[model samples]
Target: MRTKPIRALATLAAMITISSTALLTGAADTHAADVHAEGTHAADIHTAAPPGLESLVDTAVTGYLKDDRIPGAAVTVVSGGKPVLTKGYGVADVRTRAPVDADRTGFFLGSLAKLFTAQSASQLVTEGRIDARADVNDHLREATVPDTRPGRPVTLDHLLTHTAGFDSDLVGRNKASAEDVEPLAEGLTTRRPPRVRAPGQVAAYDNYGYALAGQLVADVSGQDFPAYVDTRILRPLGMTHSTFAQPRPPRIAGQQARGYRPDGASGWTEAKGQYGSWSPAGPGAVSTAGDMGRWLTDQLTADSAANRLMRQVHYRQDPRLPGLGYGYEEWRRDGRTGWFKDGDIPGFHSTLLLLPAHDLGVFVVFNGDGTDGRAAVDGRNLIDRVVDHLVPARPATPEAPRPSADPALATYTGSYRAARVSRSSLMAVEGLVGAVTVEKDGDTGLRTTGLSVDPQHGEQRWTALGDGLFRERGAGGATLAFTGDGLLVSSATPATAYERLTWRQSPALHTALLGFGLAVAALGAIAYPATAAARHLRRRDPHPRAARAARAAAAVTGLLAVTFAASLAAVVSDANAMMEAVPLGSPLLTAVTVTGTALVVTTLGVATGAMAAWQRGWWNRTARVLFTLTALGCLALASMLLLYHLVTAPLTWITG
Candidate 1:
């Protein structure tokens, strides 16, 4: 109510933004790089090192197999455009205990497949068949991106860098089998996500954008995406172990490392039906660590125009911060910048890291997402460790930053949410939990909370470098800039940015409202019947008939509200299942909508009765006040639910 109508509309307009991994928005849960440190604390599974780099890598890989950390994993290390090590760890199948073969085992590549799509599009760009800066519709044969901004069309550049502004969607991202898949062009044309931001502005990791890139590659090259990638890219790189074919071409059909989900404390549930038709966005595409290593090695050497294009920095939110390449996300470690990409599906996780500074690259794929779903986190940690071990850095003293010339230090102090989060769906809830708070640290410094980043401490202090940009205080080389029309940009995550959140959209306020409402409703549920029973036992004067009706309405409102809350909880317990369930018109979603309707209706009745009780003098002033508070609590709870788009039947969040 406090928000002006015009500002509220603006907020709603801004709500069309994105999240990653459905990602914890997939929070880019389309992750760029796990900043677990360029020198990992744990990714280096071993403390002791052998004589050679290859031997050291082998020891680190074999460390994974020891603690039952992951059932299976594949690793490939390349330096100077040559394979330093290509190895497999643990078993491909826990049930059969099939030993993983690095060159033979095919593991699902999640969003890392975008690298291929980017490469394909890059090739077309090199051939002058597709324009990197032109509207993508110019090259598409079947799919067309809507002109959300009349002057700005989503170009091949936007799609590749995750800056196309498409909303992230997890719907249909995972399927039981390849047979359930839809055709690429059909899905692209029909299921295009709304362009929430202008093309070439802000990076939001989008699977749909990559799918469009793949379609663009297919359209211009006159070959299917898979076949083109197979003949033109994979085969040429000598990546014989890789294929984009769903159900995986017959050669690698039985070669897959079965994905697994932890069943309980120790058990494993073999994950099935995990592939989807978003071939270029990941899933359905398969590659071994050894093959993925070749892909990494190729990046270091730049064998073709496409590879070089893919490696070039195409976009940056802030020059002081890490920028994005074609499909590769820019990452920094020990002040050594490099290309990094991480991917995750249901039970599979992978990371491709290229430290071109040292001519080093690492590719890691896990059959299991680990018990905590941190396969990417662990793998990135592993990468940093290897790089740190092989590559030595002579630390340079950071130049003390001159104070920011920009006068408005207070302008940067506020709570912010990631731009990659959803605005129009239940996924908007991600915005609440992922809030990043920035507060003034000194005359020219800011201390950011909630990022939980920085290699040493989860928190970081930023000393101003003028122009609203700040660098980390000491050895940490991270940079933060207030750009994108005042959006917060960081060197750590190029694909994600942060925007200031207002009071009406404040997660703390909303959470407090819901908590208070739930608490009051639950208390009323207990107090109403108990009070009636006590009065009866005490033989007190019976309330008037209309008064009894009012009391009954209040009690029912409380019960229904609590019931709706419970139903909502059960439905959203697993984000992945909810993504699949919501689009299919989930039965639980139906129940929630039904329960919510009843709760809303009863809340209205309670509000009406509150008025009646005040007019009729049906109870003591204290009792009347209590009843009114209960009514307000129920209304607040319902309002909170409505704010999240939870009351609608067949609750769909995919693009709202």
Candidate 2:
């Protein structure tokens, strides 16, 4: 699945929390405190600034990098269209012991590359080559996006705002070797995902939509996506250190930071970078802090129509949520309005935030995969800390009008799912297995549990803020409100909206159904084998034909159980292996499908035999009941497999 950037950052934050104490000790030893102290005296080294702001940022970044075991990072803070602090910290290459240089060390921008792609599209709009509100199909030269909802064509505005209804498609080939990547058009055609919602409706963050937008850029410009971006945006902005090329160019090879992941110990391991098929959507650009500084300056100071369009608030994801501009996620917090884009791949995390109100731009990137709970850094939080130091939090607002006690509040209780989830693939496991549970806490407040996948299971108490809106109590609290059809849980960005689900649509129900099916099928699979072995030892044979049918049923159920277990294990052990296995036509998935088919057929015979034995009184009531229930369990398993589209197709959980 194309993991949402917020979820990825949440995972990293959770990991950072695990080893904070020990990591902080290491950070102290790295003279991070001294760096903060030196920042006060070294104002002449950069530019004139507030006495403590630079020190605060230095302290924050060094501590984060050290505590997270992130090998290196580059940070740039732009004020008044000038970089006041552009610095690199720690080693870029562990074996070579190459120190990072802020101006030179290139970092993979990950999904932040979407900003550049959006800028390119804005340029097309400025040139009158494309219309933001027109149907996207109007610009396509190769494969057309199917209009899943007739009369509602997806527009460039939908793509820019991520309101495009395309389902998440993350199964395309991601090559560690650039040569293995196919053309953008070929990749999109091969892995085009089915649209799941009406265009211009619910905002689901679809990277594939950006891929289509890139294609549109190519179609109109008569140049490839990268070349157009280079000629139109990068060259104009003088961001010379950036390139939207996979494997990077030879000239900048040595300047690239070596990506790393935690080795499970207090050490790091090299993580090779990879390129996915939809590189243009994001995860294709590599650039230096210096280049990003230039880019941020352009965003703040440029007067071109394209730059103006890029900053326009094209879509409000939800009336209750923040608005999304052409390439930016806009939010109003602490009386300050800001726009930002977060990016993440396997071994890198990047974020760019622009507070135009404050004339402040913050860019940060880390070199770590953050898988082992040791090398995960939260760049967003770091930016927030720095911003807080520079621009103090706004004063509290006065109390609002008292909320009405709605008698219908109790009716709102139920499990809710995120709108941005994979419904057609195994990635749907995330949506189908976990859901946010909302229940009434009192007449004026509500309690929400299971809002995350973490085992700790954090719960929030929401007090009514009038109308249908509820505000979470305490610092950094979220706001929740109900739409006409569903609930919208507030997020840092509008892209991560939570969609309420009906009881019938709850993942809990599906989980319980699958759990019961697995439990009963397992009982039959084990009991029949044990019973047959005991009969053999006792020299007692039931009717030969019925006995054979029972044994066949047992064998098939056993195979089904084993196949399911193995597939689950493969996913848990190495998720990427399962992902790679999907496009290649996995043998394990085929085995599971074959066994499930046989179980479905064989269970019918078991049911028939059990019925015959019951009618003939060949077996006791206990044995007959057990056999019948077992057969029913087997049938239930088969039914579930079919219902969930797991039997005929590759198990999405295992493959995706």
| Candidate with maximal TM-score | 2
Provide the overall lDDT of each model, using Cα atoms, as 2-decimal numbers.
0.70, 0.67
**lDDT score at residue 225, model 2, on the 0-100 scale:** 85
Backbone clash tally (model 2): 2
lDDT of 2: 0.67
Deviation (Å) of 97 in candidate 2? 3.2
lDDT, candidate 2, at 164: 85
TM-score of each: 0.82, 0.85
C-alpha lDDT of candidate 1 relative to the true structure: 0.70
Q: Model 2 over residues 481-503: C-alpha lDDT tens digits?
A: 77767756465547656787767
- Among residues 3 or more apart in sequence or in different chains, the pairs in candidate 2 whose N, CA or C atoms overlap within 3 Å are 426-652, 426-653
